[model samples]
Target: MTTPQDPENRPPQQPYTPPQQPYTPAPPPLSDSELAGYGQQRPAVPEPKEVRLSFFLWLAGAILLVVSSALVLTQRDAALEEARRAPATPGITVEQLESTVTAILVFLVIIGVVLAALMVFFAMKARAGRNWARIALTVLGAAVFLYHLIGFSLVGLVIVLVVAAAVVTLYLPASKAYFDSVKRAG
Candidate 1:
C-alpha cells in the first residue's frame, strides 16, 4: 500500500537531440575563361637558365678538349721525329721520349673522360631543378670564361659569361614565376 506520486509535481523528460549536420554551401559556378586557368596551373618549381648554360659550357669544354688533344698528338709526333734526328741530348733518350708521349696521351684521355662525366652530372642536376647546380654552373662558367679569355681572347668566353650572369639574375623568384607561366602557356 504505497502512496502514488502526484502528477502535478512531476517533471517531463526531454527527448535526445542529435548534432546538426554541417552546412556545406554549394560552390560558385565557374566561367569558361576562369575555369581554363585551373588546367593551366604552373609548376611548383622551375629550373634556371644558368643551370642550362653551365651544362653547355661543360659540354663545349669537353668537345674542345678532345679536338685540342688530337691536334696536340699530331704536333707531338712531329716534334718527336725532329728530336730523334737531332744530336742525342745528354739527358734525353728515345725510351724517355716514348714514355713521355705515352703518359701525355693517357693523361689527356683521362681528362676527356672526367670532363664528360662532369658535364653529364651537371646537366642532370639542372634538369632535376637543383638550386645548388645553378650556382655550381655559374662558377664553372666563370672559370671557363676567365681561362679562355686570358689564353685565347675568344669572344665566346665573353658571351658565355654574360649569358651565365643574365640567367642567374633572371631566375630570381619573380622571373622564375614568369618563366613558369610561359612554360604553362605553351
Candidate 2:
C-alpha cells in the first residue's frame, strides 16, 4: 500500500533499437572505358636482342655438332688404322681395338644428334619466353663448356668457347628483363 509499489522495483524497460539496414546489390562490372584506362597504364615491353642472339648461337652450336659428327665418321678409316698401329694391351688385340673404335664412333654420332636436338628444343622454348628453358639452356651450356674444356683438344676448346658465348648472351640485361616480363605476363 505504500508509495504505489515503489517505481524502482519495476522490471527494467528494453533499450531502444535502430532499424536494420537493407542488403544492397553489388556494383556493375567495369565498363569498356575503365578497362581501356587500365590497359593504357601498363608499359609495353620490347623484344630483347639478346634472346635472338642466343637462339642463333644455339642453332650454330647444333649445326657444328652435326658437322663434327660427319667429320668423325669420315675419319673412321684413319682411326681404325691408327688403332691397328698402336701397341696392344695384353688382353686386347688389334682387331678388338679396331672394332672398339668403330663402336665408339657410332656411339658418339648418336650422342651428337641427340644433343643437337636438345639444343634446338631449348633454343625454341627460350625464344618463346620460357624462363625455365632459358635457365636449362644456361646450365646445359655450362656443362658442355666444362666437359669440352676438360677434353683438352682444339675442337673441344672451340666448343667450350662457343657454349660460353651463348651462356653470356643469356645473362645480358635485356634478356633478363624479357624473362621477367614473360613471367609476370603469365
Best model per lDDT:
2
Candidate 2 root-mean-square deviation in Å: 11.5
Name model 1 segments beyond 4 Å from true.
Answer: 1-43, 46-61, 79-89, 142-186
TM-score of each: 0.44, 0.67
lDDT of model 2 at position 31: 96
**Can you write out model 2's per-residue Cα lDDT over 1-186, one digit (the tens) per residue?**
566766789888899999999999999999987877684423245558888888888988878777776667887898788777888678997678878998988887787777778889998888878889888988778756654543255666666677678878888999988879977876
Clashing pairs in 2: none
lDDT of 2 at 41: 25
**Prediction-by-prediction clash tally:** 0, 0
